[model samples]
Every structure is written in C-alpha cells, then in structure tokens.
Target: MMKKAPTPRTALAPGIAKVLKQLHCPLDVMLMCVRWYVAYGLSLRNLAEMMAEPWIEVHHSTVYRWDMKLLPVLEKAFRLRKRPAGKSWRMDEMHIRVNGEWRYLYRAVDKNGNTVDFLRRAHRDKVAARRYFEKAIEAIDADRETPIKIRRCKYLNNLVEQNFRVIKRRTRPMPGFRNFRCARILLAGIELMPMIAKGQMQCAHGTHPSADDQFYDLVT
Candidate 1:
C-alpha cells in the first residue's frame, strides 16, 4: 500500500520549509520550532528543548540561531499582507529595555482594530510622537480633493496600550532577553498570538488561541 501524502497543514508554508531545509534542519523540525515560539511565547533556549522529541537530540543554541534567521523572512512576508483601509487611527508608546537602557515602542492601530504600525525608539517625546504620526499618516491613500487629514489622535492610543499589556505579561514569564535582536524577534512571534487569540486570525495549530489582559513584570 502507498503512504498518504501530507496535507497543507502538515506541510510547510511554501518558501519557509525550503529555506529552513537548506540551512541544515529538516522542514518539519523547523516548522515545529517556529510554531512553538509563535504559539507559546517561549525563549529560544526554552523552545529548542521543547522542540526536541523524546527520541531526538537538539541543542538550544540551534533554536536561537534559527529564530534569528527566520525573523527577517517573517517580517518581509508580513509587510506584504493586505490591510483594511481606514482614516482614523491610534498611536502610543510602551517602555522596554534595550541594552539595559530604557526605550519606547511606538505603535498605531486603525479604527478597524488592525495593528497599523509598530516602531521602537530610545525615547517617547513629542518629536518622536509626531514623527510616528507622520509616518503612519503617509500610508493613507490621499487624493487632490480628499487630502489626508489627521487632527489629533488620542483615543487610538489605547489599542497599543492594550497590546503592551499582553507583551508585558509574556515578558514576565521570561525575563532578561540579553540582546535587542532576541527581544525583537521574540516580540514578533508574540505579536502573531493576538491575531489568532482575538479571532482575527485562524489558529495554525489545532488548539484555540487565548487572549489575556493584565500587567506583568519588568524585563531586567
């Protein structure tokens, strides 16, 4: 008897598997690693061990490097995704530590609850705020008659604040990221969790995603 071919869910997401396979790991193993970090909010070291089956042997650093290499590819693909059009938006900041120095995260959410933009900066002053606003406003489709107009955006800020609560909770479970790259990559994985949990995205795994709202602990 012939073996049944794997379906789409069991298969890799197009280029992802091929790229990972070329880098020395099997596609299935790579996908498991990716899914673990995206679905569980775990660190690279933790994910490496979690990814290992009882019959297989793997190193934690392997997972770390895999995450680092996979991040840029994920970002590129995510940027190409279509977003719903809108006029009203929100912008806000949340504090994080980069290289042990305080930094700020700037984010924008549209009226439709879609996350519009996410940026990291060293400070959260008016200049940074205005620059973030200008950057987001430019994405609007403006015309000669219907010029883009952004008066004041204070309410939209709440969405980002709410997002920060989720991020902060996850941060508390695993603290001291040791570097910005890890923090940023792990955060990217965490960002995907909300979409799935909030019903905005279909769960990649068979299990349903869960959403939470609470304050957590410090990174340091």
Candidate 2:
C-alpha cells in the first residue's frame, strides 16, 4: 500500500488564533514577521522591507503595533501548551536592578534547558524561596509527565542562569523601562522568542513542526 502525502500547511488553515484573528494579513505572515523581528534583532523597518516579497508592502509601525497587541496573547497561549520538562530540575535567583532599586528574580530550568517558569519578587529569604518554589512547581506540575528530582548542586542551576542571560541580552540594548508593568510586558515578548526557538510553544503539535518552520512557512 502507498502512504498518503502530508497536507500542505497554510496561514488560513489553523494557527495561533486567539491572537491571529480578523487581521488583514495571513496568520503565519504576521507571526513570522514578528518572529524575525525578535529572533534576528531586526529593526521594524528592516522587517517591513523584508515583507515585500512581491507586491505587499508593510510599514515598520504596523509591525510595532502588531507586537504590542499580539505579544501578550501569544504569551498566554504559550503557557497553556503541554510540554516536556526534564526530570532533573535546577533553580536559581538573581538580582535585577530596575531604576537602581534591587529586585529578586527567581527562575527554574529543567535539565533539557527548557525554562520551567520565572518570577520577579522582592526578597530572597526563606519565605521568598518557598513562594517562588511553589509558583515554579505549579508550572512544572502542569507540564511534566513523570516525577521530578531536584538537583541540589548550585552548579547544576547554571541552566537557569543561562536562560536569564537570554532575556538580559535582549533587554540590555534598551535604555530603561519606566515601570515594572511596562518592563514585564516587554519582557514577555522578548523571552517568548527563545521559547519559540526551543520548540516549546505552538498553536498545534500534530505535525510537530518547529517554530522556525511555521514562521517561514507563513512568509513563503
């Protein structure tokens, strides 16, 4: 017997719809355009230029507005997906300087280099640790299919530290955020790109296409 060929994936077929509805552009087109802007550090104008494949012309401001509008929706959808978490868990805390005032940023990453979750808190004491642990555990419990082992070695926690740098590097170029509310929203989108790159988040997984494949598939 002959095997059936796979169906062609298209923007209108099915995608991140909570965020992609009623838009003038196709689903994948808007997603990939935003993805490239984050993944390549491309300016909005640069991304707009690239969007002109044949006749469609997009402006940078349009892309900017799309990001501000869709990023939170994307983040919300991302959190609801079922993803695998490593059995070995590593946790860490770092000092975040916002407006010269210190804040505690707690993070946990699984052995597979997937970020479990992150939070910004005001303290690093036992109470803080306990609260942070509870929060991270909630996310881990939601995703992991098996039992998890907490690795006590500080060095092992380096995995989460690396994840921290992923966001830090992206935010470094900006001058500073006016407030935590603004900062949090911006970081939601920035951190999302790496998550996208890791194949940890998507609208559908039956085909299990990588994030890049979906985004590029939309553009072309």
Candidate 3:
C-alpha cells in the first residue's frame, strides 16, 4: 500500500499542532477570538460576551490563555513568511504602562508605512535601542547588498510615531497587563495585525490577502 498524504491538521508545524492539540475549541473560533482581541478595541470580557451571543461558550480567561499559548507559535510561523520591508525606514519608541509602571516599546516602519518590527524593553537606553535594531534587521532579513537606510529626525520619524497610535488605541480598553511577559506577547499579536493589513506577508495567491484570511493562513 502507498503511504497516505498528510491532512492539513497533520501537516501543521509541530509548535502549531502542539497548541491545537491542547485546545478543546475549534480552530476557527479560537483564531477569531484572538484576531478580534488584537485587531479591535475589545476587552476579553467583551469577547466572551460576544461569543455567547453566537451560543459558542468561551470565557475571558480562556481567551487570555489562548492568546498566551497560541500567539507566539503563530508569530514564529509568520516571521518565516514575512516579506522584506522597504530600504528606507523610520524608528521610534513609545511609553506603555505595564503592571502600574511604565515601559518602553521600540517600533519601526518602512517608508511606505509597512511595519518592520517591535520590541518591548524595560529600559530606554542605548543597549535597548541596539537590541531593537538587531531584531528589526533580522526580521526584515536584510543583507549588505540591499542596504537599509535608517533616518532619525523628529520630523522624519513621524510615520512610525503615527503608527504607535493604532496600538495605543487598541490597548486603551484593557485594564492593563499584569506582567512583562503578558504585555510582550499581547503586544506582539497587536503589532502583527497591522503588518498583515499592510500586506506584509508573502501570500501565494496575491499581495493583499484579507486580514482574516492572512491570519488563518499563518496557522495552516
């Protein structure tokens, strides 16, 4: 007998399969909750209530747990297929309140306003800035042949600063993160939403895939 071909679920990346194996909910439901939480200004409680309207029972805490477990794996998969950003880039940092204290969030966007990457750090110093740059470079998969030009003027950085408002607006509804790790993971998912919107992922069918479609594709 010939060996059978792998079904979609079985063909998933090991990390994705591991996460899906543990969840009792359907894949579409889980992803919809995550996308709404990150892509919109809805709190977890709001999400739970919304799901209840459709008669699909889920708790706010369960949504939180799903975000904690599934987002990182999905993000890793996204990075592998992320498209390269523009040569000219704008970088900036913004303050975010985490656990009653303030923290720095380093973020960047290319000339066309495509997201490069983002990092949450405890401090706002040269060391943290250097680390952010390294992470962005790696995410874009830049090389010497195709040099990246970074511009650092208050006026020039307006692009990325404007982009920060989207994140802030989305987070404004929440009570606030309880710890560093939670803030980091949630923020990563938040940032990923816009990148997908900007058509940053390398879609096989076309350049601009719907946000919902792109998100589902990440897991598959």
Q: What digit string (tens of lDDT, one per residue) describes model 3 on residues 1-220?
A: 3112224454677887898778887777888888889999998999999999879999899999999998999899889989888777788888888999888888878889998778788877757786668666765555566655454478988889899999999988888888999999999999999888888888887456577778877876
Residue pairs clashing in model 3 are none
lDDT, residue 158, candidate 2: 70
Query: Residue 212: error of model 2 in Å?
Result: 2.9
Residue 68 miss distance in model 3 (angstroms): 0.5
TM-score for model 2?
A: 0.64
lDDT per residue as tens, model 1, 1-220: 3112223346444555555555786544554565566556577677756656455566877776766776556554544433443566777777777667777667666666666667766566768777767865765544435666666656656666776787677665665566777667766766655543544432335854243210000000
Ranking the candidates on TM-score from highest down gives 3, 1, 2
Candidate 1 has its poorest 10 consecutive residues by lDDT at: 211-220
Tell me each candidate's TM-score. Answer: 0.71, 0.64, 0.88
Ranking of candidates on lDDT, top first: 3, 2, 1
Which portions of model 2 miss their true places by more than 4 Å? 1-30, 43-62, 94-104, 122-126, 138-152, 202-208, 213-220
Q: Cα-based RMSD of the predictions, in order?
A: 7.8, 6.6, 5.3
Candidate 2 structure lDDT: 0.63
Distance from true location, Cα of 171 in model 3, Å: 0.9
Residue 69 deviation, candidate 1, in Å?
Answer: 0.6
